[model samples]
Target chain A: MPIRNTDHAWGSINKAFHWILALLIIGMGFLGWYMTWLPNAPGKIKIYALHKSIGLTILALVLLRILWRQFDRRPSELPMPHWQAVAARGVHIALYGVMLLMPLSGWLFNSAGNFPLQWFGLFHVPSLTDGENPALKAIAGITHLILFWVLLVAFVLHAGGALKHHFIDRDSTLRRMLPWGTRAEKSSPPPAMTATHSTPNSSSPTEVKS
Target chain B: MKTVLLFVLASGFCASAGARDWSTDAAASKLGFSGTYQNEKFEGQFKKFDAVISFDAADLSKAKFDVTVDVASVNTANEERDGSLKDKEFFDFAKFPKAHFVTSAFRKAADGSIEADGTLTVRDKSKPVTLKVKFSEAGDKATLDADTKLNRLDFDVGSGDWKDTSIIGADVLVHAHLSLTAKAG
Candidate 1:
């Protein structure tokens, strides 16, 4: 219900951004795959335009989410082994990296292919490159495909980690991030200083302890 | 005043007589078009095309223009798009490999530019198109630059599902620049 993250759970805003972006990425994966095999028709072109628009949207949203994370508090790390904690950090970093690279490569491919990109046909995004270069286009295309696969693998691992915490580790790692999960009653209220005023510069001792 | 009027008429007739037959220098001429696809503009040219031009600047009625373009020679610099354009939904280059245009009349417009009225045939469909042309003469050589616009759908260029103009625009602008040398009589 809170707009900012707590030491115990994710806030409403962060959860919304996560779930919406997750759904968009999954839908885009299907659209990107299916549109390639579609016969040369108006419908195919329409589908391609939709795919590009959604891809651009994801790119913009990811950038905003990164900026938002800077100011908001992250939930305290769940109790785990040292190696697990390190692995979790690695996966998170990889996910963010792929999220940024995937759309960038796609944009470069479109620009080099001399294809015009429009976001829902409202306006045009200027091409990043001048003129057409088939070689650059091909390379960017291959890079995009490779990044998408990386994202897919990262996503699977991420989901597996969350589920592992929920069922095996018996922690709130999954539940605390869920939009509709019931908040468990706290035996002692969190310190007032750590409640709602956490800034990017404020790293509490609790985070250090975790 | 009467002598001056007679001199002016005589000079006009001499100029008409000097307007000779011209042949296109194929290597120096080009026929191309540009169209929008997915809101992006792309240029394409017919690698093989011929234009027959005969004109007398003093007499518009005696002018004639004819052109033939090999449809399969369309090169858009993109293989995938070129391939699709030649398919049944678009140019249908397999069944119709050539497009032709022949002018019926040439007139001098109010702005002093030449205009040719012709029927352009593509994919078995013919539609009347008028080209705004500018002609200039230099010694024994002449240059002709012309442009026109046509709706691809009118010529059945992209039929069936390809008729959706939202993806591929309906309007195609064609351009031609020709350098011609007067034939020795």
Candidate 2:
């Protein structure tokens, strides 16, 4: 099916952002679980440092995606059963909301717990809380755990939906977001590839708006 | 006759002389104690703390001892509270890691308890304080119990004002029990 100008599929750049961020979030979730059983022994410091690094990166990339989404138009929605469309819309919005809240709550949790956040030994991210209050600390701890579960569930639903589209629907819905797929399927390629592939004759003047 | 009188007096003085009061045994003796600090709505014990105490009963006239406690070893179980105590605004473990107390004077009290006056140094602040100490001797071992109250504001522990006292108490109590054995001759 041809990509529509409106109510259409994701363009290459948008698809790239979604896939890359999804991959990073998945890696982060697994890393978080693995770090918990680290025995608080040798190399624990390094593990924690690595976790903080990834957490900060997720914060940055997620923020960047949000800004990009605001400026660039989203691909048109797929035509489907009314209920399926509603479910899809609700889940996508919830996915974005929880995605934003998870990292933010994680930051507050670490800050309140008084863990110095250093980005790869560069510098410390100053603490957000002052003197310790058991009640406040407990609340922050609970919030952190809840957000983690929410993020996990949202991710599974998001991935399962994508996979369902790929296998059951046999449509370009999943292919459109795969990193290796065609321009309409994948997001914009890396700057290096685009620069290398650029040629005066290959330019589609109308496609330059992106 | 005069020589005999001198000998008699010397023997009497020697008879009344007491044994040495303090020992320098680095091992087999330990000082254990508990200290509590409160912040706004959080209060916890400083668990698993040991101090070095050396003193003797016979040398009460000129007794002296030094005490040192590990700051990092404090355990409140709550990570946030423990972490705050380690920060620069509090214990400042990076700069002044260990708190110390050194005895400077001891005076016999009419009530039989001894008033051991000393300087307690915590986080670079040294404050003169007196500990009420009771001692019990048994064979080759001696037990000492001391209790003291400290005003943290005097040491700039918290802010100068008591406004923060709602969370962190203004006064901290330090209690110690030291059991020591006589060193071998």
Going through the candidates in order, their DockQ values are 0.48, 0.06
What lDDT would each prediction earn against the true structure? 0.80, 0.62
Backbone clashes in model 1, listed as residue pairs: none
Candidate 2 lDDT score at position A169: 57
Residue A210 lDDT in candidate 1: 12
lDDT for each residue of candidate 2 in A109-156, tens digit (9 for 90 to 100) = 766665556676676665567734456667776876787887777667
The CAPRI classification for model 1 reads as acceptable
Interface RMSD values for all candidates: 1.8, 12.8
List the candidate 1 regions with Cα displacement exceeding 4 Å.
A181-210, B1-19, B25-28
TM-score of each: 0.86, 0.51
Lowest-lDDT window of 10 residues in candidate 1 chain B? B12-21
lDDT, candidate 2, B1-185, per-residue tens: 99999999986664445343444233543343333322222234443344444455656755666777777776554584566667766778898778888888887889877889999888989999999887777877777778787887777665433225534566766666666666554
Q: Is the docking of candidate 2 incorrect, acceptable, medium or high quality?
A: incorrect
Worst 10 residues of 1 chain A by lDDT: A201-210
